[model samples]
Target: MMKHQIARVLVLVSIAGTCLSTASCQKTDPNRKETIPVCGEVYVDGQPAAMLQIQCHPVEGMDTQQPTITQAVTDQEGKFQLATYEAGDGAPVGEYKLTFVWQNFSAVAASYSGPDKLKKRYADPGKSPFPLRVEKGKQVDLGRIELSTK
Candidate 1:
């Protein structure tokens, strides 16, 4: 009877350990909203614009009061993946006005600051020329965006 009880306790502890491990393995955030992949490439003056910052501002018909702006930074090849809640997780479905800002990275300041390389031409959402619509359940690929510094 003592051996049986010990075995039962061990089994229970093993089951509890398994349950805890499984719960901890889950990566989903309870508050995360569903998202679809959004990617694009950017070019400035016909050349790949690396380290450019892209922002997606919610437009009319979407929640702007507590808005979540989707954003991404261009890779060396000018490629970017928009993320609203997590890296590369994409954005929620909505109409958005796209803004761009290219800044020079200062290693001395450990930041990407200084003057806007694009001269703030595409920095304001109110004055942005790029308007996009992210659809539900469908990946958005805003093919090569062309911008000008002049």
Candidate 2:
């Protein structure tokens, strides 16, 4: 269920945010108004990062200067939904940047138990960073992004 949702969101991002003109997705029904879910998942050392702050921003000069639009934080299972407006009123299909930031408490940092000392530091400071791109109406699966606390 979780993977399915993520796939859907990734698809939309690909369709709407791709930079290449060829990245555009063909409209089978151009006169319809529909909203689709573009989901995201964040993981750290094979574990889901819950409640991380994630935002979607346009690619600056490449498209409309729409500020970063944040999506709901990943749930316990690292699942989140990216909103898509009605067909014609949707985001101006173009490039986008996805950022994820999260805080990791000392208790959690001490649990990684490995050669990831830097990861401990950043996670302890509640500073996690990872960037992904969106392609408007296509799924651009970001897969897993690992951050270094150091």
Candidate 3:
């Protein structure tokens, strides 16, 4: 009877430890903010700006929940899907200062390059004129954004 009781206690302790570890792994912080899907298209010189990165910076007074920045890369069709914590998971609903960057010089040369295409000013978030607000549970569509060299 003593041996049986000891075995039962060991089993219970193992189960309790497993349960605690599993719960801890999936722990959620109270400070975590909700996120929504954000989608947009980028255009340069009236054409699709494919394979470019779009970084969304959290702006003060616009993002009261959390200051988590999100980013997405444009597809071949100039479409992008924003991601915050995961791939294509979107971002927290708030206003964001958008910055565009195209670092792939080889890809740029293969696709299209002109005086109206690559503009360095558009890559600076502080100097960029693009500002967007993402709505919760709603898809925000940023229409054709033209970047001009002039």
Per lDDT, the best of the predicted structures is: 1
The number of the candidate with the highest TM-score is 1
Model 2 ranges with Cα > 4 A deviation:
1-36, 61-68, 84-92, 104-133
lDDT of 3 by residue, 53-125 (tens): 7888766634554556689988888888888887888888778788887656365356534342455667777
RMSD of 1: 2.4
Q: Could you give candidate 2's per-residue lDDT for residues 111-139 as a string of tens digits?
A: 32334323343332123244344444665
User: What would the per-residue lDDT of candidate 1 be over residues 26-48, giving only the tens digit for each residue?
Assistant: 86766566788999999999999
Whole-model lDDT, model 2: 0.50
Q: Tell me how many residue pairs clash in candidate 1.
A: 0
Worst lDDT run of 10 residues, candidate 3, spans 108-117
After superposing candidate 1 on the true structure, give the runs of residues whose Cα lies further than 4 Å from its correct spot: 24-27, 61-67, 107-109
Pairs that collide in candidate 1 are none
Clashes by residue pair, model 3: none
Alpha-carbon TM-score of each model against the true structure: 0.86, 0.43, 0.70
Ranking by TM-score: 1, 3, 2
